[model samples]
Target chain A: MEVAGLILIVIGTFFDLFGTIGLLRLPDVYNRLQASTKCVTMGTCLILFGFAVYSGFSPAGIKALICMFFILITSPTAAHALAKGSYRAGVQLANQSVCDLYSDKQVLKISAVMNRDVITILPDASLRQAIDLLVEKGITGLPVVDSEGVLLGIITEKDIIEYKTYGNVETAKVRDAMNINVQTLPPSAPLKELVSIFSQEDFRRVPIVEDGRVVGIVSRKDIIKFLKEEKK
Target chain B: MIEFITGVLLLSIFLALYRIGMGPTPSDRAVAIDILGILVVGFCVIISLATGRDFYMNVAISWSLLAFIGTIAIAKYLEGKGFDE
Candidate 1:
């Protein structure tokens, strides 16, 4: 074998070993992904190229060349998939993130959707009163707040129907019938996470809670509207 | 000659390993492991050439496939789970 061939092989191996060390030392998912993809792809490609050179254009060299190309094409793509999966999985950034560019900060802060003012209700409110408020506003449901204005539960038309289902609509207050176990979203919560929560849970209305107070309410309709707006 | 390349590859692998150890999160570690897998395949290919055997090339190809599958599976698991409030 030529001395140059041996040198090429040495260089390729060094690149690979260096990439492995990088994979072991990185600090976070995204950063690690960057290191992993860049180092591994380049390292492997060079190493394989070295093998092709050393093999003197034999069948093994051709195979090595093919594998090198395939790795070059697929390595970066696989890294991208890993990054996206990490994002969708709700992995938090390690350092102080400069900004969440993808989030709709305004929508999360807005008091209403499509200009319909969000309203609240109390747990002790009568079913008829709750129904009347819904009819007056032409809204589906309203978040229920306590005396301190903290979110306690939610009252929706579905709650009314369920109350009527057992023929127990008499003197029971909203506390007795309203869905207490609710899904609450923080102001910074992402819409994807919100959707996941809704899908995994049995709740229709989600309360937007900020600083332990009910800021707004999100219903199935709200989610639909948000999705529609996103599509547009 | 083979020994020198293998040794240098070992050194580079150590460097990647260092990155993995200092990673801050699981995703970071996952990425690092992926890079390591590619390095292994490259190493195998070189080994096939130095030793004049077709078998090592096959092993290298298989290693690449296995790495790809592992990466996809882990990514799927990450995306498939839902967050609880």
Candidate 2:
């Protein structure tokens, strides 16, 4: 029994040694956490188990068993907490990381939830026509486009209301009331970026442009829907 | 025979100390510290067996408890959240 226990202790020592090496050699915090948590925990537990075997059913043996159980439960939990905290603290991943499952699972690209069948109005179109389209389509905004489908500007419900309150609605064109300085995002933008933009700028919708052409649009409702789904 | 195992545990502790000294991040250091704590418990157990004194086992038990608590505390501090957080 003593020989068997010694063997186990030697094996555990090697495992512990390798775990420390891995902690030093791993590229990033996450990878290091993986090495130390698994390898060291297992190694320590083995040593405790070996000690228990050597001491038999004595108090020392029972105490060794208790210590092993404590280490087993606490070590992994603590490692998990640390890893999550480091991630949330904005520690950058290693450059060679092929994929980030955490962010990938939580964040969807703007293209994923963007409305591809966008409702757009021509710059030359009348305000009356723009309003008719807005009311008929039940949308708050429409992207203004040129004949070649290049984005010109955007007209929202607020623009129409402003024109109604001040300007002669009969003589107004969509270009006269549309916001020329519109904010647009690429389809590749992450949902987190979209959330920040929406919250900071209070935009009702943002146009998704590729090659300077409006390919899709994402509204506040779309973002809310996506977030609701993520909660599940 | 017991001396050989103690020597191995001491070597393992030395390796863990190197990591703790050169670890790039707080989490790495925390892991190293945790390993060192486990090794200390192992050392205590080995010493108890070598001397035929069961009292060292009590010391080992307390050392393990302290090590576990220290590991969790460091991890929590690194996480920058309260226990509930």
Candidate 3:
């Protein structure tokens, strides 16, 4: 019995050694956590079990058993708590991480919220028609498209009003008044990227483009509404 | 024979200490501390057996309890939460 117990202790110590190596060598906190937790549990439990076998039914032996039992319950719990806490603390994963299942709720895709019923104007249309479209649809901007549905430019209420200030709003074509340089996004872009774009001065809406055609549009209100829905 | 077991346990404890000193993140340190605590319990039992004294088992049990509680407390701190939660 003494021999057997000693052998178990030897094995347990070996596991402990391997665990420490893993803790030292693993790339990130999360990987180290799994390695250390499993190895430590095996090492300590075996050592305690060895003590029980060597001592038999004495008070110390029974206490070793109880201590081993306590360890069994608590080791995994501690590991779980540590993993959760580390993630909540925003500890980033290693550079080569292949999968991340935890951050999905926080990072949303643009397709989840963008309006598909895109209101567009022809570039050759009068600026008055773009203004009417903006007011009739209660939208701030319109993507100006060619006959082939390829985006030419974007016209907003501000554009017409600015044209009225310096140019001829009534006579100006949508091509004349429209801002050709506008921000666009792919449907797969993350909400984080959208937030940065919307933060720019005088930026309110962005068009979602697919195949060089305007597929949808997203405004600040869409993001605000998405956030409000998420809260609920 | 008992001396060798005790030596191995001591080595494991040192490894844990090495991690505690070297770990970059607070969570790594906490894990190292936890492993250290568990190793100490085994160390206490082996010591008690070597010395033929039973009181070290009591110390072992108490150490395990303290280790579990301490690990949990550190985890809560890392979670950016109050201990009361």
Q: What's the TM-score of each model vs. the native?
A: 0.54, 0.56, 0.59
Off by over 4 Å in 2: A104-232, B81-85
Which ten contiguous residues of candidate 2 chain A have the minimum total lDDT? A89-98
Stronger candidate by lDDT (1 vs 2): 2
Best by DockQ: 3
Query: Candidates sorted by DockQ, descending order?
Result: 3, 1, 2
lDDT of each: 0.72, 0.81, 0.85
Model 3, span A35-89: residue lDDT tens: 9889988998998998899889999899999999999998899889988988888
Instruction: Give model 1's TM-score for chain A to 2 decimal places.
Output: 0.50
How well does candidate 2 score on lDDT at residue A132? Answer: 91
Instruction: Give the C-alpha miss distance for residue A188 in model 2, angstroms.
Output: 15
Task: Please give, for residues B1-85, the per-residue lDDT of candidate 1 as tens digits.
Answer: 6677677776766665665686555666667677778878877876676677898988887788788889888777777763532
Listed per model in order, the count of residue pairs whose N, CA or C atoms clash below 3 Å is 32, 0, 0
Candidate 2 on A1-232: residue-level lDDT in tens?
A: 9778877877876777777677777888788779866887788788888888877898888988888887788777777777776776556788556457787565468898898999999988899999899889898999999988999999999988888898987889999999988889999977667777888896889999999999999999988887798699
Q: If both were scored by DockQ, which would come out higher, candidate 1 or candidate 3? A: 3
Model 2 docking grade: acceptable
Best candidate, TM-score: 3
RMSD of 3: 10.8
- The lDDT of model 3 is 0.85
